[model samples]
Target: MENCELLEKCVFFNDKMGNMPSTASVIKMRYCREDSSGCARYLVCKALGRENVPADLFPNQEDRARQLIASAR
Candidate 1:
């Protein structure tokens, strides 16, 4: 599947699990930040780009910040 589609699926999975739909949380839970730079919004945006998804789906700083906070919990 395309990256955006994959991302959407990943988020859906997170939602289903009652977890926050943020990459950082998933990364921390599954892969931890030490192994990587953690899950950054830019990476998600890039993945969306790879899937030809609209950038507007995830505006930018605002969305990222919101996701980050949600994931921090």
Candidate 2:
């Protein structure tokens, strides 16, 4: 399988998502969604080219988004 740099750097990327590494289930990384209660990829997709990943964009990763925003500057 191809490596997904996005999932590699994403805070929501959990090794246990599918009982193994990040790609245990999905054949492709893009099809993987964070199982967290927040980012809600069902409602909104991940954002890009920002100081942070954007809380509103990755709602399932709100706390990580906040940290990313603060650490950016």
Candidate 3:
């Protein structure tokens, strides 16, 4: 599949994970490239808008993402 449209702009990858390239690479492959719809950041961005997506949110934190989405509605 194509990479996430947010790949270049994602704060998690561009800033938060910049110190850990190897780990970031693996995560990017899984969530950003393979399946962006499953990414927590992507979910929040879709549900609440990019401005509401926390900078600290991680791709694996789907539960938290869901909570944020729910709270918004």
Candidate 4:
């Protein structure tokens, strides 16, 4: 995932749960700062030597995606 995508998936990256009720619309940031200073993903990315994850990292991407589907959950 790119920096944008990874940042969006952060557990703390709540976008007001969609929008403000009064407006019924989502107000999004026009641009991303693209800094990893305040997120756990920061350490992971630092260790990986990239601003973006490369189809890896459980918190960024689903861990299930790393393996074949299991017969039982």
- lDDT string for model 2 (1-73, tens) is 3343355544344433445554445422443343332333322223434233433343334566555545655
Clashing pairs in 1: none
Candidate 2: regions farther than 4 A off: 1-16, 20-59
* Per-residue C-alpha lDDT of model 3 across residues 1-73, encoded as one tens digit per residue: 9989988998887777777889988998899889999899999999999999998899989999999999999
Task: Compare the candidates by lDDT and give the number of the best one.
Answer: 3
What local lDDT score does residue 9 receive in model 3, on the 0 to 100 scale? Answer: 90
TM-score of 3: 0.91
Q: In model 4, how many backbone clashes occur?
A: 0
In candidate 3, which residue pairs get closer than 3 Å at backbone N, Cα or C atoms, i.e. clash?
none
Location of the lowest summed lDDT over 10 successive residues in candidate 4: 23-32
Residue-pair clashes per prediction, in order, are 0, 4, 0, 0
Pairwise lDDT winner, candidates 3 and 4:
3
How close to the true structure is residue 66 of candidate 3, measured as C-alpha lDDT? 99
* lDDT accuracy of residue 3 in candidate 2: 41
TM per candidate:
0.19, 0.26, 0.91, 0.23
Model 3 clash count equals 0
Give the lDDT ranking, best first: 3, 2, 1, 4
Best-to-worst ranking by TM-score: 3, 2, 4, 1
lDDT of 1 at 29: 47
